[model samples]
Target: MPGPKSNLIDLEILDGMPDGIALVRVDGSIIHMNAALRHMCGVPDEPGEPLKLESLAVPDNIAQWRRFFTHAAEDGGPMSFDATISRASDKFTFYAEVSFHRKSLHGEPVIVATIRNMSRHRKIEEALRLEESRLEALLRLNQMTGEPINRICDFALEEAVRLTGSRIGYLAFYDEEQEKLTMHAWSAQGVKECRISNRTIEYPIKNTGLWGEAVRQRRPVITNDYNAPSPYKKGLPPGHVRLERHMNVPIMDDGRIVVVAGVGNKPEPYDIRDVRELVLLMEGMWRLLQRKQSEDQLKMSLAEKEVLLKEIHHRVKNNLQIVSSLISLQSEVATPENMTAAFKESQDRIRSMAMIHERLYRARDLAKVDFGEYLRNLTSYLKSSYQPRTAEVQIDVQNIMLDIDRAIPCGLIVNELVSNAFKYAFPDGRRGTLEISMRKDENGILLVVADDGPGLPPGIDVSNTPTLGLQLVHALVGQLDGELALHREKGARFEIRFK
Candidate 1:
């Protein structure tokens, strides 16, 4: 609407402006458009019929735009505002800030408008906001401990679906060796939208199609166009939620896939960003599950150790009482030699019980002890206790192991019998040999302590014997539900057998 003489000058000035520029009437018809403004609104290059400014606007934004023009026409002042603009027939759309001033050209009221696109700035802000949300979700997941794995997996899947703009999702545990899947979780929205009840909870790798491609190929699978025909496309289950677009990623540990997670029905096409989000969430979830399993195992082991400790404390208390009784008995002995001997016997008995606990504390497997190793240590101690003896102690024991209950009594019985050998069988420093042998015999054990010296007195009823050593051996053998027999051969041979 500029004069003909100044039209070229005004046109040149408008074209030189960086911001989009347009001249319009209050009725919404365009008077003029600069090249920048024409491109912003998706205008055609060729000149044609006069264009209406309303035609270039989004349909839903027309009402606000009309109001903006009305205010500009009446106020006769510069005005500014922000809104969304789009060409309805195309995919062109952007957030824009519009500044305008009412003017008069050739005595007709006109409006000069300038547009500054803000779409890129808004997108960057939204991306940062989403990234913050993802970090916060990961922090919460890492804090989860001792929770049921299904609950943790479900939480992770829900976040994956929400953060990726998907409406449905599932998490399945994969067994690489078996090439199978165990359905672990389904998002809450997925369950509600899916009308299929008692859905298939497992599937073999070979039987799966598109979604399983992520697992088969060991990478992410994205289907931006769900209806695109392909051999991998399979029919959905009856009453299952419909899908327009889908994405999934495989979670890998070492070189094998450990989990498969799938999401579907995103509003926009799935992209690499969605794949990255799902991968991070699923990996963190796997770590949380592993930590929970380890915590459960540690709790169970602590419980078992507590029970074992109680049993050990009980055994130690009983042994201490027996030691007290032995000291009392030694005090009643009338001879110094007999008292010294009684004291030595008591020291060996205490050491026997102490040795069992010491070995248990150091053992890899706390439930059983190496009986042969225990006997060897015991014999070495006894030989050192009975000094100045030339008798050779020959031992033949197998690699038999026994639990603490059996080991304690069996060790005490061996102590009493072997001590008796060094004391009575080898008098006058008898230059002979004492033999000890133990072996497993058909669901029972055989223990023998023989000395090549004078044998036990004839008609000695071990069951009614008044000697403390024989009495203790009888009691301990009875505790094991075993029997003791004395064979008078080249020496006194005591054989004890028990299951």
Candidate 2:
């Protein structure tokens, strides 16, 4: 007889064990079985007494199990066997490690054996194999579509169908402004419809459809059965007739999505692995497209600038030639004294206009002229006409820059004033210095040409001067739409205010 507390203690240890355990007699009859073993063997009730060990034998690998058990029983050693077992008409595979050892309890020999359920371990192994297959498929998808935009897009359509095990698939891009999904390309069987635009049909990219939902959520959505009534099932447009299993995901570049791709008519539901790879392929594709557009715009601007420069050079050259011809023709017709004066004036006028064009065409920047350089050239030309020994004259010019429109008039004004100074102020061996300074005041530009020679002849009013040069100066100054003032101190000072 056994104490009730002692029997409960033994039962508690059997129930607490993680692995299944059973005990057998030397004759191969069952002695005891733990709760783990009973549950694993599908024996719902506890054993009231010892039963035959054959009841728990795994049918598929019974011979192997029997051999291992038989050897363990005789040799009192451990043996391991992988077997499939039948319990209540259901078969389960297991990896079993069995050890048979003789135990002396009050001088009676007994064999204690342990068994464990390996069905969970087998399931884990199967799952790992499936995951590896999926990862390999993704790697192949990436490799096939990584060349550039054109090839990548072509490969993407092909791989979409291949990876999803689909017979037909369509890739489309959403035009958000147009509210349409334009089909870019499609692949069916071993051939792809490279004329994606032909297969393309417009559809609203609203929140209700598969494509719209993917874009709105910035994620992938999959439908395993298109015909079934489910939340994922959204009505397709007229052209999407054969679509069964469908998948759509937003393609993003630097967090901004310019397009969405929808793959449909796949044999099975698409997975996250496919979505991730498609996004990677599209990132490269979109980037290249953007770069191509920018390059095209840059080329366009360069061509436009070249055309404009050529046109400007052509017009300036033609106008300068026309003016030079008119001036030469005018000089050929006058009498000797008048002819000499006419040629000189004509030459000076042509030279003034020529200087404008010369500055415009020769300058790296065409918008403005170097005023100091223009003045020096003009003054040097005019000074050549005067004999150096006739007057000890000095010219002081300041450097400045002005645009051609203002520069032409400004140059002519300086030429005329300097000529007048040489002709009248320094007449009869008088020595003098001419100071030509230009400065900008708060109100306007100030042009000053002062000569340190004999003062203006007594009682000669510059406003009503009879000399042609002074009259020409007044007329040219009036043409500037500005005011002119004359000062006679030590010599003569002419100041013009371009207000």
The per-prediction CA RMSD against the true structure, in angstroms, equals 7.4, 16.8
Q: TM-score of each candidate?
A: 0.67, 0.38
TM-score of 2: 0.38
lDDT agreement of model 1 with the native: 0.83
Query: Which of the numbered candidates is closest to the native, going by highest lDDT?
Result: 1
Candidate 1, residues 253-295: lDDT per residue as tens digits? Answer: 8888999999999998999999989998889998888788888
CA lDDT, candidate 2, residue 20: 72
Off by over 4 Å in 2: 1-150, 157-170, 187-198, 206-208, 216-218, 230-245, 262-499
lDDT of each: 0.83, 0.65
Provide backbone clash counts, one per model.
0, 0
Candidate 1 Cα misplacement greater than 4 A, ranges? 1-6, 105-107, 146-148, 254-256, 296-308, 318-499
Residue-level lDDT for 331 in candidate 1: 62
